[model samples]
Target chain A: MTDYIVPVLLFAACAVALRKKENAYDLMLLGAKDGLKLLVSLIPTLILLLTAVTMLRASGAMEMLSRFFAPAFSVLGIPPETAILVLVRPISGSAALALGADLMAQYGVDSLVGQTAAVMLGSTETTFYTISVYFGAAGIKKTRYTLPAALIADITGFVVASLTVRLFL
Target chain B: MVMSWIFTGLLALSLFASLVLGNGSALAAAVPQGARDGVNLVLSIAGSICLWSGVGKLMEVVGFTGFLSKLLSPLLHRLFPSTRQDKDLGQSLSANVCANFLGLGNAATPMGIQAAQRLAKRSEGIASDELCRLIVLNTASIQLLPANVAAVRVSLGCQTPFDILPAVWITSLCSASLGLCAAWLLGKVWRR
Candidate 1:
C-alpha cells in the first residue's frame, strides 16, 4: 500500500508538468543524460568499494570482526549474528538484506534477532555507497568529516534499532 | 583522502587475513566477482535512475519542486543555512529529501546528485561543509516508510511486514538527527 505513493506522485508530477505545455520530454532526456554521466563517474568508486567489501567478506574478516565484537555487542544487548549484519549494513544494503533474510530464516520473524535485523536494515542507509555515488557524481575530490559523521549515525542506528526492537517487538 | 586509506586498509587487511585464515581461493575469487556484482548493481539501478531523474526534472520544470522547496525551506534552511541563499540548491535538496521521505531512494539519487553538483560548483578541490552535510543527510536519510525492507519481510512470509514500523521510525529519526548534529558540530570545530 505504501509503495504506491512514489509511483503515483511521479506520475502526477509528470502529468502536471506535461500540461504546462513545456517540452517536458526534452528536460527528462537531459536528466537521463545526467543520470548516465553520473553512472559513468560512479562506476570506478562503486567497483572499488564492492571489491573491498567482497574481499573482506570472502576472507572471513567480517566473521572475525563479528566474533571479536560479539562480546561487546552482547553487552549492548545485540545478538552475535546481528553484530556482523550491523557492521556490513552501512557498507552495502544488498549484503545486509541477504544477511537479514538469513537471520530471519534461522530465527523466526518475531524473534528478537529477526526484528532487530529488520529494524536495523530499515534505519541505516548504505553509507559508503551513498557517499561514493553522490560525491563521485558531483566530482567532489575530498570528503572531509562526512564518513565519520555517517558512521557515527550508523552506530546510533544500530543501537537505537536494537532498543526499539526490544521495546516494540 | 580518508576514503583511499579506508579502501586500502580494508583490502590489505582482507588479503593478510585471507593468507592467515587460508581462505586464499575465496579472496582470489572476490576480485572479479566483486567487479561483476558492481556492474550488475549499476545496471539494475540505472533504469530507475533514468525514470525518476526524468520525473524530478519534470517536477522542476512544472514548479512542483519550487513548491516543495517552499514547504521544506524552514527545516532545510535550518539544516543547510547556506542553501537559504541559493534557491536552486534548496529546491534540489528539498526534492531529494521529499523523495527520500517517500522511501524512493532510487528516485532520490538524481536530485541528490543535482544538489551535490550545485554545492560543488562553489567548492574548489576540497569538499565544502554544505556538500559534506548533504552527503551525511543522504547517508542517514529518514524515511517515513521502509518499503523495500517491508517487501522483503513479506516475501519471507512474515504475517505483518510493517510490524517493524515503530522501530524503523525510531531508528531512522535517531540516526538522521544524530548524524546531522555530528556533521554540524564537526564542521564548526574544523572551521575554527
Candidate 2:
C-alpha cells in the first residue's frame, strides 16, 4: 500500500497534465529548479543545527540532561531509561533513532522500555529540525508560539507513547 | 530571535558540559562530523525533494492541486482560514499534508516549505498564526506508517514489527490534536 503512493500520485498528475494539454515536462523542470534553490538555502541552517545537536550528544550532555530529568519523566509514566529518547526525539531524528536502537539492544526489543522507545520514535517528529528547515527556507526568523506548542505536542507524544505501550502491549 | 538564543544556549551548554566532563576533544570532533552528516542527509533526500517539487509543479499546472484542495478544503479551511482566501496556499498546504500522511518525509519537506513560504508572505518576518499552526501540524507527525520504526524493530529481531501500529496511530492523533489546540490557544492569547 505504501509502495504505490508515489507512483499513483505521479500517474494521476501525468494523466491530468495530458488531459489538460499542459507541458508537464517543462513545468516539472521549473519546479525542480525551484526545489534546488530551496535546498541550497536550507543547507546552512541544517548544518549549524545538526552540529549543535550532534555536539550536545557527543559531549554526553544529552545523557546528563536525560539523567537529570529521568525522575520527573518517570512520574509521568515514562521509564527513566527512555528519558534520552524523549529528550532527543524533538531535537534530532537520527539521535533519537540511535538512542532508541540502543535502548532496544540494551533492554531487548520486547521489553517495556524498548517498545515505548519504538512507539515514541514512531509517533514524534524532530520539532527543532522541522521548524528550522521550514522557517529557514522562507527566511522567517520569529517563530512565535510554534516552538512552545510543538514542544507541548511532543511531551504529549512521549507520555501517550508510554501509556499506550503499557496498556496495549 | 528566540531560535538564535536557543541555538546559542545549546552550543554554550554543550561546550560548558564537555569542558567540565573532560570530553572537549570528542565535542571538537563532533562538530565536523555533524556537518558531514548533515550534508550526507541532504544529499540523500535531495533527489526526492526535487522530484516531489517537480511533481508538485506538475500537479499545480494540471489543476490537480485544485482538485486536492477542494477535496480537503472542509477540514483545511477550518484549520487554516487563510486557505479559503488563497487558493495557491491551500494547494501547497494540502500537498504537504498528503505527503506527510504517506510518511514521505523527503517529499513533505519541500511541499511544507512551499506552504510556509506562502504563509510567511503576509507576516512581516514574524510567523503568523497560520504559519505557527502549520509548524505544529508538521511537528506533530500524523503519518500512516511508522516504517522507520518498523525497520529498526525488524533488524533487532522483533517478530511483529507492525504490532505497534495501533499505538503509533493513537499517539500521533493525540499529539497532533493537542498541538493544534495549543497553537490555537497560544495564537488567541498572543495576538498582536
TM-score of model number 1, chain B: 0.64
| Worst lDDT 10-window in candidate 1 chain A | A97-106
lDDT of 2 by residue, A1-169 (tens): 4346446877877777877888888888988887788678667766777687678778888678778888898789998888766766777666566567657756888999899999999899999889899899888988888899999999999999999999998
Look at candidate 1 and give me any clashing residue pairs: none
Cα lDDT of model 1 by residue, A1-169, tens digit: 5346566876786678778887877888977787677668666766667777678778988678778888999787777768767766877665565556556655777789888888988888889889999888888788888899999888888888888988878
TM-score of every candidate relative to the true structure = 0.68, 0.67
**Global lDDT scores for all candidate models:** 0.77, 0.80
Best by lDDT: 2
DockQ values for all predictions?
Answer: 0.45, 0.46
Off by over 4 Å in 2: A1-67, B1-71
Interface RMSD of each: 6.7, 6.9
